[model samples]
Target: MTLVEGAGPRTGAPPEPLRRNREFLLLWSGASMSFLATRVTAVAYPLIVLWHTGSPLAMSVVSTAALLPLLLVQLPAGALVDRWDRRRLMLGCEAGRVLAVGSVALALAAGRVDVAHLAAVAFLESALAVFYRLAERGAVRNLVHPAHLPAALAQNEARGRAAGLLGQPGGVLLHSAARWLPFGFGVLGYLVSLVTLLFVRKDFQAERTAPARPGRLTGEVAEGMRWLWRQRFLRAALGYVAGTNVLFQMLALALILRIKEAGLPSATLAVVVGIGGVGGLGGALAGGRLQRLMSQRTLLIGGAVAWTLLIGAMALTARPVLLGALYAGTGFVGAVFNVAAAVYQVRITPDAFQGRVAATAGLIGSGTNALGSFAGGLLLTAWGALPTVRAIAAAMAVLALLAAVAPGLRGETAATPRTAEPVDPVEPTEKPVEPTEKPVEPTEKGEGDR
Candidate 1:
């Protein structure tokens, strides 16, 4: 009944396929519903605000509120996830999101949708989502056999891309029908996720031999930061991912600007972005196979180089179709990189630190997105679209070169060995501690991740 961390499939035995894993299915289904709903509402927020207020500044304010959680709530939410029961935490998040989103629907139905109320709901829903995601990231390792982790995470990556592909279009269509429809759908999605979690039977973390003593919130957050800082490969990988994320955000804005400058129809922009999403989804589907064939270092370096070429290609084209094709290539490479990075981070982190570590990485990777958007606007205003894109491509080239020469990436292998070490709550130590209890065969009661 007791499953050990990092336990692989038995020798000479094929690993159990994920299709037959009930726990994983439930977890994946729930998380997928929630993620899709989040994206739908993400689009709906700006659309509804614009439709009602007709103020770009108001729309921007609401959108910014939605993203603020990634910066403000991640660390504390992560610390809380590690401290609380992960499954229960996720349940609470779902419940809170249901109410937050439903309130928006109710307000819209009653014709009382104020900008402040909308912004508050946006911030609350986003903050709860942060908690749910961190807990879900930790829960994933416990749900599947170690050998299946790559496939599991790959599927998760695919889920996210698919959501991105569908959610915006769906939101637009639903909003055209009724302003409250998207929020109503979001409420339903969270409800389904909540119901599914209630049925999951497996523990979300390894059984602790002793109860952990609660520490100061700041101290607990610091523990995760310190632990992550000690991992050379992860630190380097995070840095690389963060830098690329900022550039990609910039590139996204530039693409829109280019389309506008060229007087392309709005549908052209949709086609370009949709094609890019398809590419990301395809890459995610292939990520598990690709991970088996390439080392983490190769994927990182190759992806960076590929992105440089793709972005540089975009700078040469004002044609919508050509730009879409190049953007698709970048999306493919980015998806593969994300899968590899997520698998590596999850495999090596101890269950206890999973939330904080995952949160910290999320913060590092996505924290600068607003900056990138702001910079993209400034650069476009100052130098124009093609020139701005050329600058982004040049910056990406620098990142590619860094990936190639970074000392931390030099020793990375195709498969990272399990290096998780137990942390003593009262007196934390840097060294690994051997478990006194032997690991037993895993049971089918409950297991899976998001």
Candidate 2:
């Protein structure tokens, strides 16, 4: 376990769980606000472009600009997160987003908005977000006790999922109300996040061993990649997620095609897709409890199997109601799987590696999303929707079965249980507790012997 220096000793009762923890509540609220803003702007950006240019190409360019940073910035940003003070990094990112979005609103108000300006704003804001997300993921490891990790991460997942579910429509509503309203509201959300950050007194980063050399940033990134490459379970999990992401992309395209084939309204397709968000929210809320009840293996493997079944069911029916139900079911499994995977990763990884690990994982998953979308377009055009859906579902089922039986998941062991830092009740100082139990190392049975 890692600990900050200058912590003398425990004084009184243990620190309360996150629900009652002052710092945690503030952080959670701030993060939620930021998420809502980001989500709103995600929809608003394209709408702004559409309003100005009335060209589908303009909308695509602006939208693609936001996603570019995920592919390009995550690995380098993760290394920077490890080197920088996380609290300051988050503050800077939020402040930058506020400025970026506020600028767009101001431009719109002045009737000076253009495609180039929107693209620049989108790229810059998203680049900052890459750093902010990595920093936040690392900070949570230091913010609360090990027991609270599951719940904290679960809540975090719910925040993102909730934003995804509601942000777009909310943005459209606000845009309809006024062109500048969505970005204006987004500015307020970031302002709230900044204020919350200002109030947080605790340090959000682990003590660094050495100052990061700008010259060695490349070496640092390579080191992070190597560390991730050595972890057997995470390596397998990344591959699984990457494959599923590709399939999910196909499912999304298939849904649109299916709706058109059935002579359903476009609004019906939106409702069906939107229902999946509720499933995600439900799963995230239940994640901590499910973790406490089930072994990591059970939750992950069961989620995989469930995902296969739910997505496969889509092959048998095109009824809108059944399709929505199937989508929701898959979303639930995805949430549970994500929570379980995050908990495992956080617990097993040392504090220093959190940023890079998160970056690597995120990069791979996100990179595949682009590929998946491209592949879905091709497959849908070539094979049509029904055959494409069934083929992908069958392939996913085979992969899930293989992952379930893999050695990394056998025996249902907790992945490298981390020692929770005992809180100093009087001072509110958090330090990592030393591990008393001899948990299995990552390379047990020569599994990670690469």
Candidate 3:
């Protein structure tokens, strides 16, 4: 659907800002609660498995279960999201997550913790999260005016970083106090998210003339993949993003190894990573302004260069503080790059294709994360932390060079897609309007009053 301004009455007043947009706030806050709860449980899973079973293998299994959905569920989930009612899908996901996580809490309270049960919960929770996230991504552009899309997504990025900053530590602290505390908090968070979602009144997807015809699931997934593959710039940019994602995964492991090799306390590792989270949060907060100032090409290439430099700097320092500083720089660049790319993708993709396209891109970009972590382990085992980090840095340099010369990237722009369907005008309301034609241009208020 087209991104249009809210049509207000002939008062010539400015449109309602995001803070006052009741529907957007409900969606955002509800999503934030769900995401934070997921993060907290992410940390607790391994901790609970290892503490009870005393089996690193069991912990690995649980962790792998959590990650497996990224590979197996994303494509199908995307297709399903496009076919189903997005708000209903999200509500179901939240409900599923609550029951899954709550079961774990209840089991723990009963002094029963089984590896198989934990793995099932982790897998189910992660899979549900995939559906929720895909639906949310498609819903955001529909809820806010086009002019505020970048800002809204920036806020989303910041929320994710902040969750990362607090979730792990919060999980650890909560688990220390009680085995079931983390999951209990997760239950509460999901309940709150569920309640908020119930209050959201806007439609999650653009209005369709008719229901989409049912098709083979694989065919639907392929349709999305083909559509994304046709976008030349997005195709090439996703390649760059995938490469960096792999390297960043390696870098994360390298940092932990470096701290251990330096005989530093575990607390040092936490501090270093936490500092990186702060950097990401800062970058996310600034992303909207950065998008306004820089073109997509500039942001992507510049971010690659910045990451390369930071990785190189990280290789030279064994000091905890120095490593933290360098890692933070990479986080900052990565966050800015993510915000720019997400805004561009959301703007260019059609409302109908949003879920599939986003899922396709996510699958390509993050599918190798596990491989990177595994490779990092092997590299650290064979070459040690410093050598492995130096190698990663050199590889990042190659990606940076590729970004500079990539033809698709060179031709990228910030303009709206020419082929997007026009949105029908509606009367304006005090709340944000539905999107309309000319996705970037601001129009009169009262455009969304159905």
lDDT of each: 0.82, 0.77, 0.81
| Leading candidate by lDDT | 1
Clashes of 2: 0
For 1-450, candidate 1 gives per-residue lDDT tens digits of 111334434353544677787888999999999999999999999999999999999999999999999999999998888888999999999999999999999999988769999999999999999999999988987887665777788999999999999999999999999999999999999999999999899888876545655767898899889988877777888888888888888888889889988898878998898888888998988886676567788888888788888998987777877887888898898888778778877766767788898999988866777778778889989998899998998998898898988998775523322323333244344533444444333233213322
Candidate achieving higher TM-score, 2 or 3: 3
Clashes of each: 4, 0, 16
Candidate 3 wrong stretches, greater than 4 Å: 1-13, 417-450
RMSD in Å for candidate 1, one decimal?
A: 4.6
RMSD after CA superposition, every candidate: 4.6, 7.1, 5.6
Q: Across residues 36-123, which tens digit of lDDT does each residue of candidate 2 receive?
A: 9888988999998898789999999999999999999999998888778899899999999999999998998887878898999999
TM-score of each: 0.91, 0.90, 0.90
Ranking by TM-score: 1, 3, 2
Q: How does candidate 2 fare on TM-score?
A: 0.90
After superposing candidate 2 on the true structure, give the runs of residues whose Cα lies further than 4 Å from its correct spot. Answer: 1-13, 408-413, 416-434, 438-450
Q: What would the per-residue lDDT of candidate 3 be over residues 77-110, giving only the tens digit for each residue? A: 9889877889999999999999999999999999
On a 0 to 100 scale, what is the lDDT of residue 249 in model 1? 87
lDDT of 1: 0.82
